[model samples]
Target: MRQTRFHGRVEGAAACCSVPGCSEPGEFRAPVTPSSFDGPGSFRWLCLDHVRQFNSAYNFFAGMTPDEIEAAQSPTAGWERQTRAFASNGGDPMPSWGDFSDPLDAISARFRPTAKRQAVERFSGAERHALGVLGLKDDTDLHSVRRRYSDLVRRYHPDRNGGDRRHEKKLGQVIEAWQTLKIARAFA
Candidate 1:
């Protein structure tokens, strides 16, 4: 015997129109509320026609205020809204270094110690390498480092150096050298 698959109405269980027992087969799954309510309940099984009727007559947010309605209607209402950051002048001297009310912005604007300053402070290893590459003598100090870095940057920086292709590569080397020398504490 082949098993019969149920494709439509179940046979003769009073299967009323499913619209409060109007005596019809429940053909559609309809809900009183689109959202989950407090208690466990059941969804209504209705014929397609009645379900359409019920849907047309239903006022989902009938009792809600305008604000409540707006809040409830949107998927991202309360927290997902993007908030504008206020001017940083209100608090700390550091504009790029303060906390934000929103966690994401606070994280994004997190305090980053200036890399250039760090490079200037403790670049001994990088300095030696830079000096070796640039052929500078042992007496180079922070002042010399700054001056050489500035001069090389000016001469080779793509923007400053009339688009010389060779200087582009040279500029990169110069920056690496300067960054290296700047970090040596002895120079500081």
Candidate 2:
């Protein structure tokens, strides 16, 4: 096959140029009408020389107002138009990372189970009961559980409570619950 010199030349084109009185092979495409919302409109085949002439005379802003022309020429023209938001998270509420000092903390918080979820989904029956005994929530971390245990011990212990034997039974129960929860898989 013979190759034409121009970049957009139609290979093996048999149609004659659309330009009147021109017998050259129609190797280039030119728009027959302005494009619209429907589509790119129609095209006319032209020879190299005639296509160059058509291009030279074509004015993209021919019927546009000065303001329209200015807007079209602006760097941020197309960007000003609002675009459809992507449904990336399957309709989940978007995290407000700007409100957080560390954006990763916001993301972590979003994925982390809530106290209710932990109680229902993660903790076993005994673990849940132990958590209740320690006066800690199912969502409480190991550190918080340890702190609560220490606080309860101080509050109920005979030595810490000024040798009061009245709370010894409550203190024993607290200690037993702490022992059970300390080695629990949920806390670990």
Candidate 3:
């Protein structure tokens, strides 16, 4: 029925304090040996006064090397460890920001296909047909169209095809498509 001052005081504890020559009731627990990867080591019980003395003398960095102590005290101590990477969204891999001189342009590049689709929707049927005939995408710029037209001309032109007339029909289609797309407002 004795009143105890310490928070860890064990009621009805029969064990005597682990400290020699002390007869006080062992009411508080302290580790007798440091724990290891194998298991938690042993504990010994002590009275309130002895436990307070033990706590005042305890040093968590007691056996640690100077380097280990310094590392434990560092602000970024645990941040160097690698963590699980975020799962990708199954789309095109994001462009690395470091590769682009302009960060905003890198962000815009991710949404460019959607912007191209919106532009494609504004094109007239003839313009769209011309784009298809020239084997170009809806997002093709005038420069790209010109480059594609030149490549097609060199491929299908009878003079370039070793004077073979077999590709003359395809060559005429490419020229006509270029003519139509060149005058289209979409190219402008």
Candidate 4:
């Protein structure tokens, strides 16, 4: 007795090959139609030899074009449909920064030290802050402000600092303070 393969075969009762004029026990199942319209699909129970013959002659890409065949072979062929990244948005879902009110600008401004000047015995709030920024004495006047501005510019200028930018930001702050204090009513 030969050992029969019932791996995919129906249990309990063996089906006979559906080929015309044949009496072999059908041990394997094949699709009855290349493309099926029915549910679970119609299948033909074929014997070993017939199923082998059917598989050898089957043309999976029978009527497909060359491009269609190539696309079908690609690994990413149906990935877009599966991912559905553009299903709702029609493209990327991320909003461009230009489209929204920038939060970074607001956040940076919040963290930045406000330029509000403090009230001093003589100078106003603005003048006090400016003096602090320029490292000047509260007793300093317009002439002293000009002199200090020139001196700081000389000391911190990139050219004077041997092309180092370390003090450039400080130099800018000093210049701004001088501009503010020179025109101040106290200095006038």
Which number leads on lDDT?
3
Alpha-carbon RMSD to native, per candidate: 13.4, 9.2, 13.1, 15.2
| TM-score of candidate 2 on Cα atoms, chains taken together | 0.52
- In model 3, which regions exceed 4 Å deviation? 1-5, 65-67, 81-188
Q: Write down the worst ten-residue block by lDDT for model 2.
A: 113-122
**Lowest summed lDDT over 10 consecutive residues: which window, candidate 3?**
114-123
lDDT of every model, 2 decimals: 0.62, 0.80, 0.81, 0.74
Off by over 4 Å in 4: 1-7, 34-38, 82-188
Question: Regarding lDDT, does 1 or 4 come out ahead?
Answer: 4
Residue pairs clashing in model 2 are none
Q: Candidate 1: list runs displaced more than 4 Å.
A: 1-15, 33-41, 70-128, 131-144, 148-188
Candidate 2 segments whose C-alpha is farther than 4 A from its true place: 1-4, 37-40, 84-130, 137-188
lDDT of 1: 0.62
Instruction: Give every collision pair in model 3.
Output: none
lDDT of model 4 at position 168: 75
- Best-fitting candidate, scored by TM-score: 2
